[model samples]
Structure formats: structure tokens, C-alpha cells
Target: MIASDARLAINPNDKVLPSFSHMADAIVRMATKPDRRSGDLLLWSDTFASLRRLFIGVGAGALVGLMVGLNTAIFPGLRAMSRSFLTFLSIIPPLTLLPILFIAFGVGETAKVMLIFIGTVFVISRDLHLYVLQLPKEQITKALTLGASDLAVTYRIVLPQIMPRLIETTRLTLGGAWLFLIAAEMISATEGLGYRIGLVRRYLAMDVIIPYVLWITLLGFLLDWLLRLAVARLYPWYRTGKE
Candidate 1:
């Protein structure tokens, strides 16, 4: 693959592709450099910062989504209002609202987090509402027959059913969250994996771009794997056990 890329790069009209040797040297140089802008340490720190933004956004969004979803499911009075609002949010392109987020929340971390939040929250909420509605009606009746309150029914019967599903939904939404995060970083972040990649792209730094892209891919894979393991281990009943 590198050889073919080298061949293509050798053509004057084609884009330059750094050889493996150049890439490796770039990695070594980057890893040892003390310059915070492009140093490997800086990259990792920025990556962690971005991860923090992602984690907080997804965590808060999922929790809010679940609460709002369940509330609308249990209380039909609020159903029309909440459902319509969430549906409105779900249909809008999140990227199109970037300027609004920046204007409302500013171009700082708040806007970035809000961007990610909007990207995944409504979708998760809608899916969670569907899952809640699909639950066996008999369970609610059974819990009520035992003298359980509405809140008790939701907590004991519905919440348990959706917890695992929520985790799974979050696993799927991680991709969207990453997209929003990178887009936010590319737009205004001073330090982040996305910012670094966009920065290097201006100079046609293939050696840096390739590794950064691979690193982002690896991080995403690991996050998905961890979520899968959590579902398998913590919610064994939810697992299909297909493997």
C-alpha cells in the first residue's frame, strides 16, 4: 500500500504521500519534541480534552434523554409537547446549527460540548422512547396490581429494561458524537486531534495526518469495544450471546 502510494506521489501532478520511513521518522520526531503545539504529548493531552468533552456531552445527553423519554412515555399529557420538541430537534441538521451554538454558547468548550450534545441527544432520546413504549404493557399493570405507584413502575419495570438498551444506543451514537467533536475542534479549538489534523493538512503533512487519522480510528474502536464489554458483563441478560 505504501509502495503504491509512493508511486502515485512520485507523479508531479499527484498528491504527495510520505513514505513509511518518513512517517516513522516523523512519529519519532514528534514524540520526542517539546514544542507543545505539535508534540506528541500535546496531541495526547488535546485528545484527552476532546474525550472529556465527548464523555460529558454523551453522558449528560443520555441521562437527560432517558429521563425525558420516560417522562413522556409515562405521562401522556406531556407526550405531545415533549415528543414534538424532540422531533423538531432530531430533524434539524446539527452542523447547520453550529453558528447558533457558537453565538449562543460562544466558541469555547461549552459550544463544542453543546454541539456534540445536540448531535446525539435527540436521537438517543427518541430511540429510548420507542424502547420504553414497546415494553410489555402487562409489566406496568402487574407492577400496579402490586400497589406500585407510577414512579415505582417506571423505576422497577421500565428503567431496568431500557438501561442496557441505552448503553447500546450510546455505543452507536459514539460515531455521531465524534463527528460533532471533530467538527467543533476543526472550527475553533486550539488543541485537539481534529485541530491538529486540520492544521497539518494545510501544509500537506501526510506523515502527520496518516498517524493522527489512525489514532482517532483506534480510539473510536477502543471506545466501542469497551461499551460492548460493559453490556456483556454488566447486563448479561441483554446480551444476545450470539458468539
Candidate 2:
């Protein structure tokens, strides 16, 4: 009855866009059915494959970005040396580097992960650098006056304050991360959300395509929610400071 009602809501001649019921049906079919390219089920395998790339790429990038931001903000000389280069990287369209990445790294998982990492790392790093610099110089002076070493001031005084900001930065960059992941997967991956979407596009598989796109969106939302939850739980003080 639900399916029939959904069909009635849409024009019978329309084949380009699937109704919500049709999309739900296609999602189930993809979830249960084995992929033609891979023996594993379509949605399950593709989702995880994309997620693995997302985690590795974003995880590594965030860690490095945090360090870059911290060190650059602490040391003016280092910031001067690399600031322009980092700015250049952040502004260049990461998608434009896809071909070069594929050529340099080949069409493997490495290339896909690198694409996401490169896409996000510079932006996150720069944002955090500016954020850290905004912090009062009095805090650092007090820490040094209290006999804190340079490293001690950085990790002890500054790191805790910035960790929450890192999470927020990661949340903001998640969309770009997905974009790079999808673009890389579409170009060469044998099995991924983007791979499947690109593969089925030739056949005009709106049912599969729509569901997969929605699934990506759902996954992104869940990730963002989780990050927000983590920030709230782990750094209540951060929010209190903001308030």
C-alpha cells in the first residue's frame, strides 16, 4: 500500500527520479544483493570501503594538522617559512590534483586516502594556527614565568584548549573529505560508494544512485553528530569558556 501510494504521488511516466518508497526499496535491494563486481553485498561493502578511506585519511590529516598548527603558532620563524606554501595548498582545488595523485600513486587505495588527506590537511592546519594565535599572549607569558619549558607550555597549556577546536575543524572539513573520497573512488576504485555510483551512472540507475547519495549524506550527518557529541562530552570546559 505504501509503495502504491508513493507511485501514485509521482507521475507514472517519470523514470529519472525515484520516489521515497522506490528509494527505500532500492536501498534494501542493494543491501541484500551481492555486487556484480565483488561477491560481497553492495551497500555494506561499499560503505565500509569508503569509511576505511575516510577514517585513515582524515585521522592522519587531523593529527598532522594539529601539530602543524600548534608548532607554527608557537614558533614565529617556522610559521613564516611555511605559511605561504600552506596557503597555496589550501587554496588550490584538491580535485584538480586527482589526476596527478592517480599518476603518482597509481589507482590504488593509497591514492584515494592521499586525496582526502591533501584536501583537508592544509585548511585545518591554517584554521587552527589562526585560532591559536588569537589566544592571549598573557597566558604563554604566565606559563613561562611559572617555569614552564617551551614544550611544557605547548602541550600543557595550549594543547588541551585546542583539542576541541581540532574536533570542530574536523567536523567542518568532513564534507570536503567525502568529496575527495568520492572523486578518487569514482576514478579507479573497484568497489566503493563512489565506484558504484560511477559504474551505475552509465545505465541511468536512478534507484541505486539516489539511495547511495542519500546513504553518503546520512553517513556524513552521523559522523558530524558523533564529533559534536564527543566535543560536548570530552570538553565541557571548552563550551563553558565560549558561553
Candidate 3:
């Protein structure tokens, strides 16, 4: 019933654009009101699915990037071997891989998640590798002098020092992650913020599209703010720019 109402609200050949009130009303109805068929209130289920995708992409990408970066920085032999490959992967535009990814992973959740992961990992890894490399050699030397194992020093000494920087990098890459996510969902998805926008676009549902865009922006801002707060609260010793 809600979908039919929405369909009536938008006609494919209709040149009439919806007014701001109409758009706002549509957005409110879709978000707060219920559908006769689904019985589930609002689009919260879709929102949750999108949120899961976002957190998974960011968490996994950050973890892989940090591990690869640390390994590259700490192991000279591994660094020399993997440097060229890293550069190669970094230069290849992630979008160009969409076709290959869809082909390999299918038009499913895995493909979408992989898109976000691949989009972010290289930049994050490179930034972290450079950050680690920039650490003062004296610190490593001091740790060695204390009879600390290289593994112990890298984990206990180096990781803590760079956590703030890693958080900053994660914040920076979020935009690209969103871009990749939206593109993937637009190409192939049943439900996501991007999927909803794409689905509604067929009937020129500017109302839904606009609200979805604002929601995505709001979500990104909140995530970035949370990361900043975590840095301040969890790692009080690391001074951010405002400090």
C-alpha cells in the first residue's frame, strides 16, 4: 500500500517536480510510518543493514591496513619484496575493478563489502606505513637496548604511539569508503541507503533521494566525530590538532 502510494506520488513520464513540503512529507512518511505488507515499522531494517556494511568495511579495512603497514615498516626484507606490489595495487583505480569484482564475487554482499575494503585499504596502508617509518630510530634503539624482543617493542611500544595517527587515517578514508559503498549498491543491491535511492530514482522520486543523501552525510559525520571522541577519550596522551 505504501509502495503504491509512493508510485502514485511519482510518475515516470511526469514532468512535475515535487515541492519541498511534498519531499519532506514523503521522507517522513517512509521513515516513521509503516507499510501494510511488511508490518515492520519504518526503514530501520534497511538502515541497520547499511550500518552493518559500513562498520564491517571500516573495521576490516583498518585492521588489514594496519597489519600490512606495520609488517612493511618493521621487516626490511618483506618491505623490499612487497613495496612494488603495494604501489601497483594502490595505483589501480578501485572503480575499474567493479566489473571484475562482480564477476568474481557475484552481485552479492561480498562484492559490495570487497569494493569498500579494496577502495580504502591501499591508502590506509600507505599512510600507516609512512607514519611508522617516520618514527624516531632512537626509540627502536632504546627498546633494543632494554633487551625487549623486536615483536614486543613493535607491539607494546610502537602500536600505542601510532593509534592516534591510525584513527586520523581511518577518519580520512571514510569518504572513499562511502563512495565505494554507494557505487556498489547502486550497481547491485536489494537494500541499502544507496540501493533505496537508486530504486526510487526510476519514478523520479527526488524526495527519497534527497533525504537519503542527507542521511548518508549525517552518518559519515557522526562516525568521524565518534572516532575523534574515541581518540580524545581513549588516548589522552596523543594530542590532536585542536590540542
TM-score of each prediction: 0.91, 0.92, 0.89
Check candidate 3 and list the clashing pairs: none
In the range 44-124, model 3's lDDT, one tens digit per residue, is 756777888877988898999998988898888878987887888888888889999999999988888888889888888
* Candidate 1 residue runs with Cα over 4 Å from true position: 2-15, 36-40, 241-243
Model 1 lDDT per residue over 3-25, tens place? 64767667733336766676777
The order of the candidates by TM-score, greatest first, is 2, 1, 3
Better of 2 and 3 by lDDT: 2
For residue 51, model 1's alpha carbon misses the true position, in angstroms, by 0.8
Question: Which of the numbered candidates is closest to the native, going by highest lDDT?
Answer: 2
* Deviation from native of the Cα of residue 67 in model 2, angstroms: 0.7
Report the C-alpha lDDT of model 2 over 1-243, residue by residue, as the tens digit: 565456656766454766677778888988987767667888999999999999999999999999998999898898898788778879999999999998999999999999999988999999999899999899999999999999999999999999999999999999999999998898899889999999999987787898899889999999999999999999988888575
Assess candidate 3 and give its TM-score to the true structure: 0.89
Q: What is the C-alpha RMSD of each candidate to the true structure, in Å?
A: 2.5, 2.7, 5.0
Worst 10 residues of 3 by lDDT: 12-21
Which pairs of residues have clashing backbones in candidate 1?
none
The deviation in Å at residue 158 for candidate 3 is: 0.6
Give the C-alpha miss distance for residue 24 in model 1, angstroms. Answer: 2.4
